[model samples]
Target chain A: MNRYSLNQATTKYWPLEDVVAASAKAELDWIGLWREPVQEYGVERAAKLVADAGLRVSSLCRGGFFTATDDAERRAKIEDNRRAIDEAATLGTDVLVLVSGGLPAGSRDVDGARAMVTDGLAELAPYAGERGVRLAVEPLHPMFCSDRCVVSSLGGALDLAEQFPADQVGVIVDAYHLWWDADVYRQIARAGDRICSYQVSDWIVPLPADNLLGRGMMGDGAIELRRLREACDAAGYDGPVEVEIFNQQLWDAPGQEVFDLAYQRYTEHVA
Target chain B: MNRYSLNQATTKYWPLEDVVAASAKAELDWIGLWREPVQEYGVERAAKLVADAGLRVSSLCRGGFFTATDDAERRAKIEDNRRAIDEAATLGTDVLVLVSGGLPAGSRDVDGARAMVTDGLAELAPYAGERGVRLAVEPLHPMFCSDRCVVSSLGGALDLAEQFPADQVGVIVDAYHLWWDADVYRQIARAGDRICSYQVSDWIVPLPADNLLGRGMMGDGAIELRRLREACDAAGYDGPVEVEIFNQQLWDAPGQEVFDLAYQRYTEHVA
Candidate 1:
């Protein structure tokens, strides 16, 4: 209960103020936020609202999508990441999650796209570090490797993160994205101090047509959530366990109900 | 053209005899077989049909689904694999590709399920070797990791394969499954002599509702098909380059049309 955080995305329709009020009423110590809603509500005001409610922002939703064919587009994405870093600092959170962009349109050069991620990170890591923000590379599930995040494994994320100082760049271990890997436990051990955030969700089957909404609630699917959480704990990641599910059903439900259900599942399956 | 093999799954509705006759007409040296269709047509007759058409069976579609909660069910699956080995031998193909079953029903113990795969392989490898059939572990994409194949990466498949005699058990290098892996090239190099069959299919975005049929044809998606084929060749595999795509569109098309298009794409994008 002390370490539980309800990521705002789980209840997608929940207003920023409503989520903050709910978290405060629930006596939750942390809440995870997304950039759009934070910016819409005003970053400083959102930060003050959470602080006034005695809650901290676990992380800012995202900051990377650096893969681009055009030089201007690539530069703009990096610049956007710079702004994202500033937003994370403004919101009083140290971690900014990154979903490295997929291959450029009509491109088959995965290695080239990955190289662009490296270049983007190289340019942003120092800037992020200076502002007390850690860029957390969130390796999406390999299914999303083609259209969403090119970083599809924790090992791959660590490969990118290892190029920079641990404080500047780290990896996010989301159970939904990584529970499939046989090497996960070993990689979690390897992650050690580079683990910036630990997210919990289950791997449900027969993914939605739009598979981006395919994540299941913590206790309803196949992931060993508590085991992964314990592994992160053993690896020295003593941080908030954010409940970050992207399911359409949860989004359509009442926000308070979804938040309560997520917290309950977090206790049963993740804590 | 000298190395191309049409996996029967690519032409799902084509009768076994028609596929063999078509391969013969196409001057193809190889054709991959699926067990159910061969069994339906009678294995010996299908074998003779393929041999009569002068098309050697490059590999068998599958021979694994070993995860089972019940001990008796597990034993039956192992026995079924033995029959599959004999079937592969009768078809005169040494490679028997295996899609290790997903986690058992209502089970979250992935490691436990994986142990079942390891144990299943151990029991069947010797039997397969005796029949001159090398069990080829095909690592399905990570999306299939939950409900299709618990062995989700070439590295993970190789981990299981390395525990057995290389002649008895090897890994399949399927481009669609391994393409998204950042460490895939390194893993392919490590596969060396353990490589059994090389399969090609493209990774397309907006995966269909049934992602099992989400594979796109060569030159139609994001995979670097020729590069992967070359990697297999560099790893000392001089076997048939099998085009194994499972797509609803291809299945609905005329068999001859699909076959010819596949060959054209093979020459342009894979060969």
Candidate 2:
């Protein structure tokens, strides 16, 4: 149906209610939201607002940041993920996004961290599965390989997924991250039905300073979106294509203006 | 013995003969050379000069840009690799560095290109193995992901290595491309004596416009060199810690001055 979901981090400077209101006005059927906004206006209040607006929660923005030098921090992250899963379940969202954490502090050991992630995921898998929410490991761009997700490829994510039960693990292929990967096509095919969600954004060359929020909107960058969507279709994916940008500039604009521009761009490019 | 090899491309602007003389005068036991010098001076002449100077060739600079749309073009690359192996044999180099090609013309499919690389490598392995030369896949920076090697992570390179015979496949883990990776230690361990070569360079933050050549000389950038070297040590890697700087400013300096500064920096920080 070419359904669209706006990930609120795209314009996170705006309040959750404002974003929800904008989505409802735009007639977007779904939304991918961050924990920060959900917390700001209590989750209870956020829930009521979503229901009031008649928007489906596509997936939670994220949960996993599992890498840690010590056991205590890792445990804390696991507990946080448990809370995130509960939130997703409460929201009736089918998926909880997981960003595999980057390297631990003062430690150059990545495999150990990856092992730690696998252990953490395996421990958390049962709880997520029991709640009917799958863990969607989102492979971040390789530029973030050290400080962000260690699982930087769809193939790497799928390889990790293979270690657990199919019902328990899947992946979120963020276009901003996956677009630059030369192996995206075959990996997406290999991901096949395990793809829990698909996202849309652009890989802005000469990435803006303050990179965490510098993501460009779809069609503003060089991503081959239709081809990616086609790959998703070729591999039996029929989920909502979410517009999840993290642009500071967009957040400064009026919500109505941002959504209209995003919707138009999504239709022309990503949809 | 803690020996060093000057990769000629580190001072790429210099003439082949001059670069060779500089390496020899610097008292470096070995040198990693490129194809251009050989092409300019003829392989026999270049080989004789390095031999007369009593310097060993640690490895040849490169062999593959195998990714391409045309079938015959791919075949020609394979044939070129064979010639590179022959050149390696004549120059007494033990390895040939291979940069995985970028996206083929008008193509955004990375997996297909990777498959082409894997197939091409499988074909090239036997020829290289027969000549006592090994193919060392050097994963470039993530910026080159769309246009360079599909194997971005050390683990990705390791996975590729697993496909071929023990002596035939290995990787070159450069500090510049991999310093940010959390999995560096574990991947090096898994690389397990499969690490045929190690290249050293530093990453400059606020990347320059000509990112390709604007590398930071060691001690000028953010990498924790000793720890990474320690990981390489723990992984049973006894290969030469080759310095392969690609900085435009450094390139402009006289060859001897660059080598003197490089050795001092390596000893102080990386050794």
Candidate 3:
């Protein structure tokens, strides 16, 4: 109970104020925040709201799409990432999740795209470290490799993160994105202190038309949720266990109902 | 091209006889065969039809689904695989591509499922070797790891293959599946003589309703087709470069049109 943090995206339509009020009512110690909504409600206000409600931000949703075709575009993306770092700092969260951009449009140069991700991290790690914000690289499922993130496996994410100091650049372990990997357990173990966040969501098949919203609730799909959570625990990750699902069905449901349901499922399937 | 092989699945709607006749007319030395269609056409007759057309069978479509919950079910799948190996022997092809089955219906034990695959391979390897057929383990994309094949990377497939004699068990390097893997080239190089087949198909985004048919034609997606082919060559794999695409658009197109288009793209993007 002490470690549970409901990522705002899990109940996307839930208003920021209502979510904060609900988390406080439910006596939650932490809540995950997204950049857009936090900014929309005013970052300072949102920060104050959470702090006033006796809640802390577990993590900021994301900021990394560094794969661009030219120097100017790449530099601009890096600059945007720096602002994201500032946002994380303002929110008082040490972690900012990153979904590394996919291949540059019309390019089959995957290696080149990966190099851009490495360079982006190198450029941002020091800045992030100074701000006490860890850029947590989240490896998306391989299905999203061509269009969402070139870093498609935990090992691949670690490969990029290892080039930097652990406190500065770490990785996120999202079960929805990594449950199918055979090497995932070993990678999670290898992640050790570098694992900045642990997220949980099950994977259901016959993915929806929009694959981005295909995640299932914790107990409803085939993932060994508790097993993965335990693996993260064994690897020395004692941070908030965030529930970050992106499903149309879940989003369409009533916010409080979904939040309560997710909490129950987390206890039954992941905690 | 001496190394070209037109996998029948690429032009799936074409009658097997016509695919054979067209390959003969095109002066191709090799043609890939699928199990159900060949079985429907009478295995002996199909074999004679192919041999009579002066075409050698490059490889048989599949022969694995070894993951099952009960002992009886597991044994039945193994028995079916025996029949498939016999069919491959009758067709005079030495390669029997295996798409290892996914998890048991409601099970989340991925490691247990993988162990079943390894045990299944151990049981079939000697029998397959005796029939002069090499069991070629095909690692599907991680997207298919849940409902289709659990083996999801060249390195993972090789991990299973290395447990047996190379002549008895090998791996398939399909560009559609392995192209996104960061360690793909290294795994291909490690494969060495354990490489039994190399299949090609491009990967396109916004996967269709049925992801099994999401494969794109070469040059239509972001895969580095020629680069992968060159890597296989560098790894000492001189076997047939089988063109295998499974797109609804390609299936609906005229057979000869798709066939000709595939050949052109194979030359432009893969050869």
The candidate that wins on DockQ is: 1
Note the Cα lDDT for every prediction shown.
Answer: 0.93, 0.81, 0.93
RMSD to the hidden true structure, all candidates: 0.9, 5.3, 0.9
The alpha-carbon deviation from the true structure for residue A8 of candidate 1, after best TM-score superposition, in angstroms, is 0.7
| Interface RMSD over true interface Cα atoms for each candidate | 0.7, 4.2, 0.8
What lDDT would candidate 2 get against the real structure?
Answer: 0.81
> Per-residue CA lDDT of candidate 1, range A1-271, in tens?
4899999998889999899999999999999999998888898999999999999999999989999989999989998999999999998899999999998998889999999999999999999999999999999999888787889999999999999999999999999999999999999999999999999988888899999999999888999989998999999999999989899999999999998888888888878
Query: lDDT per residue, candidate 3, B2-76, as tens digits?
Result: 778989999888999989988898899999999999999999999999999999999999988889989999999
Off by over 4 Å in 2: A122-132, A159-169, A179-194, A208-224, A230-237, A247-258, A268-270, B1-3, B11-22, B35-49, B60-100, B104-138, B148-198, B201-241, B247-271
TM-score of 3: 0.99
lDDT tens readout by residue for model 1, B44-113: 9888999989889999989899999899999999999989999999999999999999999999998998
Give the Cα RMSD of candidate 2: 5.3
Tell me the chain A TM-score of model 3.
Answer: 0.99
Q: For candidate 2, list the clashing residue pairs, or say none.
A: A10-A245, A110-B182, A110-B183, A182-B110, A183-B111, B102-B147
Query: Any runs in candidate 3 off by more than 4 Å, and if so which?
Result: none
